[model samples]
Target chain A: MNEPYFREAEERFCELLKAYLPYEDAYQELYKTEVNNLPLYGYGVKGFTLSMIEAIMNITNNKGDLKLVEGALAIGREILGKPVELLEDVESTLKSLNGDYRLVMATKGDLLDQERKLLKSGLAKYFHHIEIMSNKNKEDFQKLINHLDCAPEEFMMVGNSLKSDILPVLQIGGNAVYVPYHITWEHEKIDHHITHDHFHQVETIKEILPFLKSQSYLTKETLK
Target chain B: MNEPYFREAEERFCELLKAYLPYEDAYQELYKTEVNNLPLYGYGVKGFTLSMIEAIMNITNNKGDLKLVEGALAIGREILGKPVELLEDVESTLKSLNGDYRLVMATKGDLLDQERKLLKSGLAKYFHHIEIMSNKNKEDFQKLINHLDCAPEEFMMVGNSLKSDILPVLQIGGNAVYVPYHITWEHEKIDHHITHDHFHQVETIKEILPFLKSQSYLTKETLK
Candidate 1:
């Protein structure tokens, strides 16, 4: 539930470039082209790393050295290898809700990378199912709901990104609780001006407990 | 069980390059580097396409044009979009084995692309489960076996590549039946000198039926 994904990537890119101008320029071009072209080029740490290297080369007006390319790729691999931090109170919240409802972790990324992270996270025991998605669009949410054999009104999603985690669920008639992460990827950010009966914005992951309690979404048996 | 995967990719590459020396040179270099670097770079259609584009640019002594890069990526996307043809007797063979044993389709590729091809293939109904793997190493097989809640000995893998489908299973103490495809990726090629009690090499998909029947692997209910 916690990922300063873009921030971490930018930090790594800046560290590799060691020049603010090139790093800034590369970041700008990468987000502009790569985000829009993700469906065409596909999405993952590997593609992002390659795109960043290409952007840096173009902005610096230098054909990059092979060794330098290897260095940048190493950063990509590092990003994949790094474990994502869980939001404070995430485990307790999951523990409280575990048997009351089926807890599932739904995230989008390279399958191997995500699977490796889950295995390393020490959070695998909390989830009934772990779904690593390629993309999180409305249709993907619909497919997941179908797979679960649950009515849209009975499904609830909680995550940091409005575009990916909230809007898709609301669109499919499912309840969604938005827990804003400290840092959000530009690709995942969107205007939150719309109104919906099933949507609520919260400051942190822990707030979802009281919100769900207020909404009668969870039974009192496990609330203790 | 039928895929001209490598052949088609090479044809597309040669057509784009229109020069044997560079094509051969790029292909050799790409396999040498990409395969060795797979654990770091990760594997999939997108990564392979990016590596090929980088390879071509190096061999041709030119920075790749954006349009040319797009064309090469289009080739990769094309491969992902192309559905593998089922061998002539595959449907009948699967139908016979359908009830006798659980059928699962395990393939390696980009997640979205593979899911798309599976949806388009009209062959999704034959398998009880579908696994889209990032790579076909023994560890990946071990993970699958763990997920399936079965021991290695209970598994039987049948596929086109000796490296991917057969050897990994054999190494893990699982039964493997190798049904060689007409065209195999050079990277997937390996010497088939090893033998085990559970290993069988068949000429085609139909031959597997008779072999399994003789071995008493299939229940008599289906063999009749």
Candidate 2:
């Protein structure tokens, strides 16, 4: 996983929300309306979707009925023309991979904007499927494994986080390769559960090719 | 910056060391040595040199006498060997760069083994100089900066640990591009001082090229 997605999403949402309403006022109102169950009287569908996604992503802990108010505010902000900077290299890196592996993206927040960006950049074709999950838990792992119909040993989770992708995959008996992201968020804590043999952490995503080549299952035909 | 070096060095040193000493006896002798006192005994000039390199690279915590001892033991176990595995790739990457910049290699520990390897592998020509220090601290930084006669801002420190490379460089107003090593030894603590700045916490050495290029400081003429 890359840092740009979450950082950009948060920034875009914050900027969009701030434009339409006073930042603090909007935060309070959204909190009361969506999270506090004060009734979202004037909010539209977009507002509701954003609130829900924010809640799922755990950005807004259920402090009150206003729990998802932050989400609604973010959604409103995103819709009002906030510029979310796209990661320029992401598409290029994805395009250059020579492997036949499916890309199931696991992210921590609402990815509607990101999904569209991928499509626009023509990177949607490379992935067999896409998944933007709020968390990396047993349920998410099982869902991913079932989707591929592959055993844990056969599956490899590649991401920039050892706390998220690597640890979860290792816990579920799957292989994981960590490509450390340049910018790590404050919330992504190091998993203390990580054993020495848990996962292979490499510096770049490109390193994955050589690692895969080392594995017996990755055939030249499949990789090509 | 990569695990292969330590692994290879460990292996090569062990193979060569074993030819001269019995493995079990070496282990018994090595285990009794103190961690901070590694360079006291000559395990093998090459083995000790590589061990020093590994130690300085922050790959292992065994310092002084114990570093050589454990390194010898590890070599005897066949877990580490001369980093022949990475020689081709390292050479290839170096070649791909087309001698764009003078490589100033700064490594922790003693420099003899690595120097020998570099010379043998024909990588010595690419580097303008190589300095091996027990630790990268204020003293070492000042010395290198003075020797190069370059401003702190003009130089970039590329290495594995944040505690060592990034923080010290940043403290002295020099830029640091961190290429995280594959395996972080237990001693390399996460620097609590790291601020949430993307410009500072570099995940790859390649990031520096573009950054330097943006400033017109990485031109062929400047490097030469």
Candidate 3:
């Protein structure tokens, strides 16, 4: 994905997640994991793990086959009592898939809110796997690399902030796209240098979509 | 003056100035006469002479106690109407009146558009003496210093660009507060070395009001 557009989308998605998720701890856990790279403590880990299980269960359904993703299709109808479509209007924007490109998300804490929301929201159908962890240091990032079975250069990490999204990916020689957020909490502060030459700065999210589609390494035709 | 706050206000004021005066040639001329050491062209010299006439006319009100000064002010007023408000605003913001300080404007043309507007806008009440120039270069800047009878250290330059505002001021051993505009035109490109430094960035116009009010060389209390 183009760096600017992906960053914008990720920022918007995070904002929506904050509104939908209950409890202060959920927000704290999410921020720590996604923004601060801090470890998830006792309840946070369990809560996150449970949310992921809920998401997976919702995806499987009783039919035992995964359906192609549709925007805004709510998963976990049995528990939530209704289908919730979180992905909304942007469904048609996603590129058509071929099996060559595997989609994955590396997040801190156990998969909880985002995973469940993604499946419930019908966004989970696009990704093959999601990795949720309590830590996002060098070791965890390396583990993610191994799990994905992809080289650093081959994968592109997209997120908000130069501290979290850009620094680690750049350290590993991976391409990273940063989307600056309008609002950042105090806890998200991380010591990171943002030299003009090191990273690309962009104002909006949609600008990156064309770039992502153009990159051959992430495209189905190139993979085949 | 509080450096940070003054910097912010100076930036805001510069942004407004750029919007009202967007031509590159005018900006170059203004810079050449006001900051850079260079000689004024025919129209620029005429404009400067006319401005001196207007200043004298304002003091003499045509009754000719200072006929030479009044004559100069009349010619200056004929060339530049009320744009002098820009200078008056700066004068009103100065913190004290102990030393001679000159008003230098970096613009891109031979006419004093900003100076005329300030006078016509009913803002002239705040300023006593004014100098208007369309072209500013190193030599013109030196002439301005001589006209004001002050050393470069005792002087300050307020403007919007690192290339035009901060760099030249620092080169002359003068303090400068840069107020960056939200959008910059293609013609205003600066050397990469100047913008890379964090010391020069400012965001707002109101922040510098207090800083100017605190300066010992200019009197803010008397200005109002």
lDDT (CA) per prediction:
0.71, 0.50, 0.43
* lDDT for each residue of candidate 2 in B1-224, tens digit (9 for 90 to 100): 33445445444544434544565443333333323323322222222332332332232232223333334334422322344344224555455455676567776532333334454567656666666554577666877777666777667676677876777777787766666666764345684666633235445545555565675554555543
What is the C-alpha lDDT profile of model 1 across B96-125, one tens digit per residue?
Answer: 778777788899866776777777767788
Candidate ordering by TM-score (highest first): 1, 2, 3
DockQ of each: 0.30, 0.01, 0.00
| Cα lDDT of model 2 by residue, A1-224, tens digit | 33454455545444445534555554444344444321221122232333333333333232222223334333444443344444445555666562556555555432333344455556566775555443566667876687567677777777776776777788887877777667875445574645545378777666666677787765443333
TM-score for candidate 3, please give it.
0.30
What DockQ class does candidate 3 belong to? Answer: incorrect
lDDT of 1 at B158: 88
Candidate 3 A-chain TM-score: 0.53
Stretches of candidate 1 above 4 Å error? A1-29, A50-78, A81-83, A149-154, A192-194, A220-224, B1-26, B53-78, B81-84, B95-101, B149-154, B171-173, B220-224
> DockQ winner among the candidates?
1
Give the root-mean-square deviation of each candidate in angstroms.
4.7, 26.4, 28.4
| Candidate 3 lDDT, A1-113, residue by residue in tens | 12233233334323434434444443444444433212212112222222332232233332211121111112211222233443322344333441555656665422233
- Residue-wise lDDT of candidate 1 within A97-216, one digit each (tens)? 888777778888666676777877788998877777878898988978776666788888998788999999999988888887767777877865758888998887788778877886
List candidate 2 stretches off by more than 4 Å. Answer: A1-76, A79-89, A96-99, A191-193, A196-198, A217-224, B1-224
